[model samples]
Target: MEPIQLTTAVMTIVNASRIIVQFMQNQRLKNQARRRQQHGDEDMNTDFSKATVSSNLEIMVLLGQAHAVERRFWARETSTEWWDHIVLQVWDDSQWLRNFRMRKGTFMELYDLLSPALKHKNTKMRAALTDHKRVAIALWKLGIPDSYRSVGNQFGVGKSTVGVAVMQVANVIIELLLSKVVTLGNVQVILDGFAAMGFPNCGGAIDGTHIPILGPDHQGSQYINRKGYFSVVLQTLVDHKGHFTNINVG
Candidate 1:
């Protein structure tokens, strides 16, 4: 078993190294050509230029690397038409992976399902947007409210892109995270003794509170809740010992 594991690990490393080498070679070719062009060497190759553009391995490596870095546990499928495809994967299942595939969907289906414009205005642009890494990061960050901006910054995307990604992925989270009633085990482990000390069920208790929000011009009366203020209602649940169990935003 140990030998087999070691061999598998080595093979994985070797394959990865080969890809990296190919990537470096591609970049070197591009850099040299770019420098030559910048230096005013106007020897424009007729067929060679077309061949080089078509055989751009660096671009391939970049696409692969981008996906590798951004995506976690990704898998995908393609359609007969080169223009159409889908991808599939799960996220946030590192610890829970042993249990099951946490979040589930075909990648292309997911992109198609969530994309504001189902079909890209440009065919080439749509293909690029379907990249596994880019989409995965965007989708994951959106689901995490606080992490959206931070994650978006890492990928050089704006906050709004992150916001849209989150909204798109929010449904998956709701299905996975909220499908089950707050389990006793989940609450107790997270809350740590808050459940037993006369708190609510499964070692958690809930409290309602009001928070201030920006007022609207069109309908001033729209903001009023039972408390009668321009506020949003928030619910916080704590475990038996009073550690935070969950937070709900209105």
Candidate 2:
């Protein structure tokens, strides 16, 4: 054979061998990628199954707790019988006055005046208290220096309920009667009465007292009075009849 032809044949054989080797390497890489994808899919499915099971268990536990709470009943110790049987039926007028600081008739009158503002309607959840009862509760709380819990036991109501009643009645009284009840009322007569008592040109008697209070958020130290207790000053002017003519509180 000629030397040029022999060299050309050798070059063609080498080129063919390179192509075959490159094809085999590409096929091997594809197989490896396929195996990796199958393993990843299996791991993802297992993780999803575990998460679903865990979520289901949490939901079941929550449902069981809800059912248990619904079935449970919590009863409280109350003395409604005392209020209904003794206070209303057995207590006399003097007893009423002693406890409430007002005669039964006066209490009724006050209730009649405040009923429109203090009344609450009965609902399916509970029956509303009578207007007279509400007034009595307020009067008892204001007349005595007792804790809300103590007052609640006496009235056969919850402590929180007693607190609510007192606040409601007090607010209503301030809104409806403060202006009419606490007034100078015949200024000339007041001056004349004070003059007869040897106080010249005095329309009323002025006095100040410290009302005990919880420490306030703003300037709490300022509320500490000389007596070493937190309090606000209440200044008042009263006429000869001892009716409040003017008042100031801080």
Candidate 3:
């Protein structure tokens, strides 16, 4: 044989492998950050169901845009498939299948809110049984008014149950949204807004209104404004610049 140069070639290959590994690590971190930005939310917590987590992650990845179509829903990979293939393979062995319907954060909130009422042994209705489905159905109906009866039918409950569920979820959502999105003003901000309109002393303005309802039970008071029928008088307060301050919804 003429010559063999295995050692030199091996060293060069090892150095190249190290550089390649570092590049891949950097690329992966950058990809994770880009993914976070694309979704507009942080990554999931550790305790979340693996199947649900994987399903959500795959869905988000495949369909991240406004008009993204879900291939998993079309039949390739589903929650059930993910549960069978990946979730069960993990050692923790959580009930990822049943937990698939609920996002972990929402599930946690509903569980905390309804655990007391649901824990009662005497409770019989479906709503009192499972807070996960109840909360989901409630949220779905709030945005889709027409689907109330349909969703109720699916759950073998009345439309009123759906309404109640939705109202509960809506109340929680409203409270959270108000706290986070609504910017509260101190006495200074209020005074500044009023001062802009040259009405510093005026705390607010009062306007009288009436809402017509079924015929009056008393059938005597004629002070009920307009509509030529039974109505309740309502007084609303507005700020100097016409911002609504308060309303006595009688």
Per-residue lDDT tens digits for candidate 3, residues 177-249, read: 4444333335566777778888776566688866655566675466455556567777876655565556665
The C-alpha local distance difference test score for the whole of candidate 2 amounts to 0.78
- Please provide, for model 1 over 5-92, each residue's C-alpha lDDT reduced to its tens digit, 9 standing for 90 to 100: 5665566566577766766765676677677877776563333465466556645655554444321243233232211222232233
lDDT of 1 at 121: 34
Global fold similarity of model 3 (TM-score): 0.30
Per-prediction backbone clash count: 12, 0, 0
Tell me the deviation in Å of residue 125 in model 1.
1.0
Report the number of the highest-lDDT candidate: 2
Which candidate gets the maximum TM-score versus the true structure? 2
Better of 1 and 2 by lDDT: 2
- Cα RMSD (Å) between model 1 and the true structure? 20.4
lDDT (Cα, 0-100) at 176 in candidate 3: 53
lDDT of 3 at 148: 66
Residue 46, candidate 3: Cα error in Å is 75
Residue 90 local lDDT, model 3: 55
